[model samples]
Target: MIPKVPSSPQAISKALHSQRSKTFNAFYASIRSLRQTPVEPVDPPSPADNDFILSILRANPSLRDTRSYLASFGVQPQRPKTKSEAQLPEIVIPPPPLPKTSPSLGKVSTEEQHAPSPVIHSILNPVYKRTALVKIQGPFTDVQLDSITRGLAYLEKLGMVSVIVVESDDVPKGDLEERQLLIDEVMRVVTSLERQGSHARPIVGAVVRLGPKPGAEESNTDPTFITPETHIFPSDLTQIRSSLRAGEIPVVAPFALDSFCRSVRVDANDAIAGLACGMVEAGSDNPSEDIDLTPLRLMIINKRGGVPSYARSGYPHLLINLDQEYHHILDTFDPRWKESHPHSFSDLALARTCLQYMPPSSSAIMVSHKSPSSLIGNLITNKPAVSSSLPHALLQGNLRLTPHTPTLLRRGLPIQVIRSLADIDQVKMTTLLEQSFNRKLDQEAFYGRLERTLDFVIIAGDYAGTAIVTNEGNPGSPDPISYLDKFAVLPSHQGDGTVDFLWVALHDESYGLGHPFSANPNGGKGGKGEGRDLVWRSRANNPVNKWYFERSTGHLRMGDWVLFWSDAEKRLKIEETRRGGAGLSFIENWESGRLGNWAQVIPKIPSSWK
Candidate 1:
């Protein structure tokens, strides 16, 4: 039988503090229980059942109805027909023409002079093949010839199996007035192919004219000089018929050329250059992979422990302290203030300013010490009224100005509130970070050991706080840290760096560092004091504590290097330790004693050093 436990505040606090200890004992007990009895595997679905479901859906006619009775059985209704399908009419075909009378056999033939031409019948037949004729009339520049060649090459590659080119002189050239007549002939061919549906493939046949060969001089001695001219036009109907019969996609030289001309008149060289630029833009011809810039959730806490406020008293001078600073923390983090001080500005300002350049898709969440009730009340009260004058301030200066009607904010998805650090335990914080990072902790014994070592917790979400629990094995222990680590929080409370630490910790065991358990694999023999290593080692010895330490360390290392925002000194110390160097050393005489060996690798201290 389970023992009864009190749910009083004192009992709860004790439980929260001893979360890690309780979690370890519970997990150990669970593993022991699991070893005694193994679980059975689930059975797979039968093939006959799958086939029956598919057949039932396909054969059911009532499934087509929007409010179909089949829906009662969880079957989806078929989609309704679209407007295009309903509007289209069925196609109709005309009867074939009657045969002509035998004029030669009868003395006075019954054949009519106005009888429909055979060519017209052939053109109307859907199965008949038709060809597009093209002609090019030019003074014959090399560029024009090259363009035509390229067009022809493209057509050949597309498998227009029957393509032919002829010289302008090969056919009778028409006068300028009959140019329309030539275009009409070409349109007729295209129309014929359209009527043929998929049976016919359109062909582009061309005839080109060279006005005169280069380097051939004109006769200067003639008394009356005649200027040579180039004219490209379709030949008469007779010539078109002859060309058609010859199986050449009909062409009438220069005029036919105009029909084949495509939009965008650029040479091959320009086309190649444009392609090269596009390839470069597409990043070396490997199809561009999209960059994911998912927004990060950040939990901000006032290190000073309380909310800062500012009020104007009767005094003439304005006072500044923690109160005033609390309201302005957002402004300090904003990128604008750096511009006001030009002389003191450095690369740091430039780096901060770069954050503003990120695309609109990127986002961040800021949490403060505001009470949940106050925050919710403020949100409801501030619902926008009919505002003509520059809508009510969207953000407290420097905070990203999200719209008041934002979907996330309106849904109460932004800020989370915690009254104090004790409200959240280390396990919850670790779990929050892990969920944010989309990581799963290593399930191996290493992770189990690390999990029991975590004592530090950060109360995140919109409003942030830090909780440090010392889980000593006790009867009034709080919920197991393992349970707390599985809780999911609002997206805004999840900071990328915070989540990154959890992810790193989860993976840190493989790296042989970061987590206390993983870092000191020899069972915690490194340092004995309450120094950083010792703090890490003590945490690592407990499974949960080690897990939390590894996760936090991992996050710290993987997170962005926002110098001012992060603990710069702590980061430096960690790096030096990892590199096997002493942390924050101030050796007076490096040439003597223990420092002598390191002195050989170290350069002389700067002369400016006191």
Candidate 2:
């Protein structure tokens, strides 16, 4: 009475027998391997095999229930099959007898037994409960969904409560089936973790999209989402404020600071302070200001080579040049110097004195000057002159002063002028001179003159020569000749008894007998040579000079005067003379220790007169 079968009974029976034989063979092989090796292999099932098995089970309706299939195969059910079987008393077998144990392998010491397992606790664990609003813009594929699920699983392992906030906009249009598949995968992962006692909470929620307002494009419209758990709303301000108040640790994300600040309704300063505090707490040594803008003073002394010649010379000519140019510009701008001639000198002297006494700052630098004219041109152009052009080391030459002969100018003695009181000290003077000169000089010569004279030493260029006073005298001595001896030159006119004339003139001026030299003509010589000559002659017959000479009679030996005159003649011959009185007349007698009348001799003017 059974309905006519589509296939013959014999054919169906044969097919079933073949299927059963194949299943038995597979099971028998597996059982044999397990029996042979008690320890099971740790390898996971191949992905292909797993997929195939899953596909077969899904396709076969009867095999969908794995428990029924296992029962048919005579496999013991996880739970007792019948009530009678479950109610039966369980029979427990005795364990095998223990063998004699070796002390080293079988017996563990108390210390070893009590020792803790080397299990590492992860700091990344979500110790603090926090809810983050993650807005995922996507039409994710199955693989992508799986990846996201895996990531959530990792978070769950670390004790995090993860929830997926799903929005309709996130699903692809006309892909409802695929979207469902994604949801199913997510649900699967959550279910699997829950069954395994993991706290993986996957949530599904929708985001409400507001239509664009006014002329804005629809794409530009933003969607708002809700998160009820942890009370962490998606509003940027709320999140930031909460983070600040709670002292929540900031996630390491590349978020825009300005945007973040605007969203949080917090000032940048507050954020910065918080960040600084956090950094310090985290053991960072840097200050907040430093981190914001780490400043460094980079001074690059641009030398031709890494090691400049000026540096080797121990003079910073480049620095000096720049300083001098600055001073010159200042002088030009200063109204006081322009209005009064005497005031200008006083100002210059004061400046020089200040420079002489003061020590250089720690950051002083030295450089070389190869182009002298270019440097001077820059100065004239009101541009800052570099020290490299006038290296101070070049000032180490001898500075010689010859009286009144303009031809001796080639000797370069007149150009040796010092600008400061520090210029009086040999070491400082030489350094300054070398800077001005931009060339290396004889250090011994320069330093010796500096110590010996204590008078300002003159600076000279590389090709430009130098001279030193040959006479020896104590520092600060009042003798005019002694004082003059400190300088490279003395101004004396040969047969005119110019020394006597200068002495008389100086005395007269000091006593308010003679007028001061008419305001220096032609703005004075601008450079070293012109300046030196002007200063020498201007002061030679100065009242101060006369007073110094007259008052210093005891120190002024006749030999000193005679030596002064002799040296003066060697450098500059007597060219012409105008008799003030009988020539060679004894104006004063040293042995008598009194002012005495003298016999007059004829004045002798040299043939080399102009």
Candidate 3:
């Protein structure tokens, strides 16, 4: 018989949590049993059948309606016909007559039930194509724990199996039991939610602990640190693989066993690295021979959120090019902070190390507990929470105020800079521009002017994108004025931060336009004032103006074009004029001259579009 649920939702929730220890195994076993069950001819409902139906209804109250309630038993009730179907002659076949003595809840024939056929469990669930290895930094409050539980359920709904590694960095080394208790508490919360059917798709949580390697030396290193000898692997992944194939989310505690079977505290990041290395070793490198589950994502959930940006205070880098930016990010951390909190450094190292073991396509995400949905959002879109293409300076309101946003780290493509225009591949450039703008390039005219004015070009990933800057200063004009001639990215790379990389390369001092440049109205050479002034013009109706507005200090619209310029003094003058300062006459003269007399040179620049 179905176990009697308490009178209310609160009571039911209480009962589930209270009976967690006793019901945990049985609850998972019931799911396994249901999956293994085979389809058979329909028969009159027995007491056992009634109990099963009642159990399902009580488990998920959302299936209270007749159609949904019947769906649980693999039965679909006839639906009402639409206008099209109603116009046709409808034939109604009543359910087979029930015997007066039959103990049936309702009539359900074999024709009405669409049950699944019997097959081996492996055939039912092949090696999952997408799996996420998640590491959650613990010592969570009740609210945070609940958020994580919901986050895991969201991952399941998105069709990715989650393998969680719980971090014990917050727990003291002397208290090994507390670490285990934390793991147990996590499982308990997951179990209670599963029992209550809080999520549409059920998520079952299982605990798996790492075991020490045979003949490995006893760990004398500190529990908090990750030493080579202290690191332990899931030597035999039989248990982990089995749980995954069975569709269970394995919540692994960082504690492991030694040769003597004593619990050894391991660093959570090391545990993840160990798992990553083990996965690589267990599977073949060749695609045709590989049968292991594909490790698609690595997630780090903690309070600090994604990797911090040393340059931009109170914000995380939206994307990290591990190949290029890893060393830079590591160097940016203060020596004192690294010494005080080693785990912060270790986590950054872990992302780079683990990604090297997985496929080139595999990436990592670091998200905060406050934004659990961001985990699902990032996974679904495979993009950063804040777009890199947006102007960082212009970001305001919540996105700017919120420090803990998700960051995406990948083994991204290298940026290639060609200083001399002679080195650029014209064919690749043509193809990229055509793909990005959906327009044919007038190569002869484009190259004709570029031959004289081209300052430099930055290519990303074999011409997936390019940024072309040129000197647009009038002849005999002493100051060099940098003009963005063309900025285009292949459609495939539009949102993946290729534009940002190209933009960064455009302004990098090593290339040409010196960043942190000084603004001198005199337009003559001296100290920082010698740095080039930057300006660009876009069509008045172009969609990229918002992005331009955010990065540029000032802009003015003309007949069919809008001119944007980056200069500190000019920007302040415009703001001052807007506030009714004495600069209004200067603004009027600037506008009357049409972008400080750029009208003389901008129209002279030949259009590359046919």
Candidate 4:
């Protein structure tokens, strides 16, 4: 049964603070029961249902006589056509990624939703064949050529990677020199395969330049949009499947940088990522086991390991043959900040050329000390994308993030302060959480929750790697307490001082620090919290409990919630009062945890929103 509401704020306050033993449990039991209140069968008159619409028309009788009103205006109704001329409105929310369990042609799955590290499902499963898709930076010098040849030999020896994709877009710039260079490289690779002693030679083909798709660039108002350049745009991937089907390696062709001669450079990272995505769209196919076995691999090799040693955020791709004019333009921006944040330079036209594009995926950008083939062997033989012993830092760390125990943090990445969920890029945020939590978030439900309950949200690193401090306390209470909600860090970035950064930032926010970041840049900041003391809860089985317990001044175990507090006095008071059978308000806060209807959208997504 639903509990009766107290008539006034004073009555509610008195009941909340009541000393009677049964009052705490009775109130809590009622609150718990309140959550279970039988919802009316909404089908009859839902906001958009026919009954509701009819009721609205009934309330305003004039609105129901639209036909007569139209007749007075000399208008007449007509039968609907097979298809309405009206285009369906543009979708605000991007579609969810393809399912990893059963990926189809051209469909790539989000890494966060799949296994912590996708070491190739083909390894254990007999259903899919292992294949290699190499996207290397072109016009290589003698040294790079030797290294690539040796790398291919090494990969072939392991038989873990087979198909190689050479794109024409990476060809060197010139009237015909760039095009010739690509053709020559293809011949070189084909020759190399034939000369090698009777090993299974990979099927090679050159994919032509796949430029912007039909009517795609229209919605792109950002004069600065670089998605098509960095990431494989989904619309044009069918060409890749066709090339693959014809036993040809798809190569990138030269794209126009201007009306005449200038050509865009090749982005090896995006090339590899793009071709692999094409294979996904083509769907998995059975390979001939009678010959060589190879898992699909996308290889990018360069002097600098695709990523810098330190972490930074931007589209993933390497710039090739930078000209003196372009170099002069790049000189304007700080080299350091430019690497960390590419969005800083989208305004400069020449600098714009430097941007490389790759879509968001579980593609981990790492600095490989070993050769390409050597890394392939390590990948096939070992698991854990970033092994504990190896000290190599992952560049573009957010892409490879999965919800496993994080490795210790090495370099301190910057934390971004977000006051409301609206300020966030919801699509990107949703993608990151889906991967982190390994569950799908209902798009509308996620937005609705944020609209009503979101108060404070903080993100660390390129993607959201932290929590939302919400559900602080009920109205009328002097100190309602705040919650640390939906806290998360990529396993690779954990232990690398991320949590410590978060702890200090939140503490400072409540302790008279500047709002740090502007709230909900989408709108205005929310009402400030009056109370300085904060409280949060964690599940009992969470591994992060040790980290929470050590940092927290005190804690309490109530039901399934193990509440922790930064305030020493408050923590002890709750602990002692509860033991003595004296009433406390902390229990109420626990009841309120994850209580909103919107909360279900992201529910217990991850443990310890610390």
The C-alpha lDDT values of all candidates are 0.25, 0.25, 0.58, 0.39
Best by TM-score: 3
Judge candidate 2 against the unseen true structure and give its global Cα lDDT, from 0 to 1.
0.25
From the highest TM-score down, the ranking of the candidates is: 3, 4, 1, 2
TM-score of 1: 0.18
Error of 2 at 163 (Å): 3.8
lDDT of 3 by residue, 93-178 (tens): 54322222223435444543433221112111221235678887876776776676666665554355676777645577678466
Alpha-carbon deviation at 410 in model 2, angstroms: 73
Per-residue error (Å), model 1, residue 135: 51
- In model 3, which runs have C-alpha deviations exceeding 4 angstroms? 1-129, 174-235, 255-264, 277-292, 335-342, 359-362, 396-399, 423-431, 434-445, 474-480, 507-533, 537-596
**What lDDT tens digits, residue by residue, belong to model 2 across residues 1-610?**
1112225556445433443223222322232232221221122223322322232322222111222222222212243347787888987854222223244445544553333111111111112232222112123444443443333333322222232332223334456464464455445544544443344433222111112112323333323211111111123233332332343212211112231232212211122222222222222222221111110100111111011111223211122211222243233333432342222222222222222212111011111112212211111111112212111112222121011100000001112334344544455444443553345667665444545444333333321222233223322433322123222112111111112222222222121111122111112223112111111211233333432332232222222121111112111112113333434333322223211110000011111111
lDDT tens per residue, model 4, 380-466: 322223332211122224444332111111223445567766688887777666776666777676666566656677766677466
Superposed on all Cα atoms, model 3 deviates from the true structure by an RMSD in Å of 14.8
Per-residue lDDT tens digits for candidate 1, residues 9-79, read 56544543444233222222232232221121112222322222222222222112211211211222334
Best by lDDT: 3
Q: Lowest summed-lDDT stretch of 10 residues in model 1?
A: 310-319
Q: Which is better, 1 or 4, measured by TM-score?
A: 4
Indicate the residue-level lDDT of 155 in model 1: 24
> What count of clashes does model 3 give?
0
RMSD of candidates 1 onward, in order = 34.6, 38.6, 14.8, 24.2
